[model samples]
Target chain A: MPSITVKNLSISFPLYHENTRSLRKMTHLFISGRLRQDQHKKILVQSLRDINFTLRQGDKVGLIGQNGAGKTTLLRTMTGIYEPVVGHIRVEGSISTLLDPNAGMNFGLTGRENIYLKCSINGYSKKQTQEIAESVADFSELGAYLDLPVRTYSSGMQLRLGFGLATAIAPQILMMDEWFLTGDAGFIQKATKRIENMVQNSQILVISTHSAETIAKWCNRVLWLDQGFLKMDGTPEEVLPIYLNKPYEEIVKKD
Target chain B: MSDHDPTIVKEPVIDLRSVSLSQNVKLALTDLFQGLIQWRLGWKLALLDIKLRYRGSILGPFWITIIMGAKISTIGILYAYLLHLDLQHYFTYVAISVVLWTYVNGMVNDSCLIFTSSSQLILSQRLPYSIYVWRNVFCNILILLHNLLVIIVVFTIFRIVPYTLYFLLPAAILWLVNSLALGIIFGILGTRFKDIPPIVAGVMQSLFFITPIIWKVSSLHFNSNYVLLNPLYPLFEIVRSPILGENVSASIWIAAIGYSLFLWIAALFIFSKTRFRIPYWM
Candidate 1:
């Protein structure tokens, strides 16, 4: 029953200049009629343009795009981090996002304490938190390291902790960025297994990455974005060649 | 990321255009209500804020008490001698006033950075915006509790007992409400306007001298009616007079309540209009 319906969604960020961000200058300009003139022509960076899509149960969607092509913006919008500018996104399930590994981390606290903090933020019960701690401790394999401050953790160790915590509870809809996959090979393998298991139980999965092989192996559908527009939307067989500018067989074999 | 109960099927209709003024008000109220419900989380975050700030220190949060005590004793003695006031009574008066002023100063100064300081957690997930405000309120309250030790010691040493100690409850409640209002108003403005934090700090510095904290209002030799116009006067008087066992006039209570109501109205207006844009500003 989990689904996401995005309707003509467009998001733009108002680019605040140095003077515009200052209240003193803003009030001064207002009195001089310059603020009104500036208001008529404000600068905005269009992060996402008129776009429409619907994701439902059993859908495994891959978002393929270059840097600043709005893949991350789209994911952020779906997860309710950024509001839409032109249209709406109606979400019908709980969402879990793996957008940033260091998002909620307090580096001064021990890793175990951070786990408790995050669980509390998410409104988990005491019993559920204990279970999550055990799962994260087991999955991350950072036995004694869990007692140390997270600031002392290596990048790979931090990734392990973030990944394990994010994946501890199986969500109805999972949205992930490409950075989650960057780590040691063994960790990657373990992470892939964990994601695969969650995807199997989850209603929908949306991943943004530049890896065509990853799309070929995992996604049932592909959304190729170029310069803030959805350039193509179809199966990997139909869209991969058009997006990668190569034969479908070549991209599939590359996996 | 925010996690929810999968069993409860809550459909979120994310439409910014559809968020009318009334809807914005509702959202603002819900945000405050939900935040109050999550008081435990706020308390925990506040405790950690105090703990991590003084981590590895010998006395931990007691440093707040020591620092306040030193300031009070130094200022109390020096100012009493300069003003040629009675030593014992003036010292006690300054002690209570300084402690209350520290709480007020800390709340106002910290309110500006409440949202901006937690930009990391704000951007990562969705929670009631008031939770951040409550976190700030709780942190200041924790610091106030630490500073209270100094006042307790001062009272015991002087053998001074406040007769109207019960009045402190309503005064503390008023402070809590005002702190929350300040948090929401300044929290939003500080995030949108880069100049607000410094402006707030500068204004607070001047107010500390203008308000009757170190100096008594009775010594001014002018109509205290003009002094009553200063909003902070009543706020300070309501708390300080009670602890000093002075009678709190009904007019002082009225002014404190009036200022609180004004603050909440401003806070609601600003928060409802701009709460959704906070993350984007970050």
Candidate 2:
């Protein structure tokens, strides 16, 4: 019964420049007769435009786009981090996002402690965090190393610990930026398997990835973003070929 | 910030609109209480912060007292003489005042950076933004609790048993309401304005001298009327006066309560409207 309804969503961020960030400079400008009322202008970058989508249980969607095509913006928008301008988003379940694997895990705290810390921020109660502590430790394969600070862990080890917690949270909706965070060969293989299972089992999965083959293999549906607009929305089978053929930029170049 | 049940009980779980005053109040209260109800999370995060700050040190959060002790005793000796007050009574006044002042000081200073420091957590996860604010307030409170040990040792040495130690509870609640309101306003403003945190630091530096933490207010025969207008003065009085076995001044209590109410309303208006902008700003 989990669902997400995003209607005509758009997002933009005000871009601040060097001079604009300094209140002192701005005030000085005002006093020195260097600043006119119209001189103070705010610049905004529209990252997403009129995006509309519905995700019910058992929807596996791939968000495909170029560098600035608003893929990550859309994911963050759903998380309620960035409020949409002129749109409504009604998410009917708890959400877990893998925007950054290392985002919440404290480097200074021991892995076990960080599990509690990370899970707490992820909205787990202390008792719930305790319940999952064992499983998280086991899944990470950090063993006694879990007692050591995360700063002591190798980069790969840190990634494992992060991935373990991200998957273990088990929220109804799972959103990831790059589908999988690749490390060395062995670690990436293990991570891929774990993520595949987690993503498959989650009630809804929306991932942004550059891997067309992976999209073809995994996604039931695909969304292609051209700049801020939703250019194409259909099954991966229907949209992937068209996306691969035109690539948005080349179409813009022809125009 | 409010978590709805996963079951589809309603058609629209969230509404999108420009922040209205009533809706803003509801959002602010819901977020505030959500963080309060999850006090465990805030407390744990506070502990982690304290542990990390004092890692590899024997003293841990005792550093708070060590610094306060050094500052208070040094100032207590000189100021007691200058103000023509007894050393024991003066030291006691200075000790309690400093602890309370540090709590407000640290809370105000730390509040601005709460969102910026936790930008990673805010972006990657969706929890109540108030949780981070609470964690910071709780961390400062934890430090205050540690520094309160300084007050106990100081009190015992002076053989001055506390008259209304229990009153500190309600006093602490009042202090929290004030701090939470200020913290939210500053957190939101700090997120939007890069200049705010350092500017706050400078303002606080100046305000510390103006607010009578080290210097006794009663001892100040001149400029006392203007000092009465300082909102921070009543804030210090409510907590410190009780422990000193003095009746809480109605003027001070009224000023502090009115200030807190005004701030809460203003903070809510700002917070609810700008809450979503925080992540983007950060």
Give every collision pair in model 1.
none
Least lDDT summed over 10 consecutive residues: which range in candidate 2 chain B? Answer: B8-17
lDDT of 2 by residue, B189-253 (tens): 88888889999999999998999888877777786767768889887888888778988768877
In terms of DockQ, which candidate is strongest?
A: 1
* All-Cα superposition RMSD per candidate: 4.7, 5.8
Scored against the true structure, residue B234 in model 2 reaches a CA lDDT of 82
iRMSD, per candidate, in listed order: 3.0, 3.9
lDDT per residue (tens digit) for residues A192-243 in model 2: 8877887776888898988876666677988899778899889876787687
TM-score of chain A of each: 0.90, 0.84
Ten residues in sequence with the least summed lDDT for candidate 2 chain A:
A31-40
Stretches of candidate 1 above 4 Å error?
A18-40, B1-17
lDDT of 1 at A188: 89
Model 1's alpha-carbon lDDT is 0.85
lDDT against true structure, model 2: 0.80
Which of the numbered candidates is closest to the native, going by highest TM-score?
1
For model 1, state the Cα shift of residue B6 in Å: 6.9
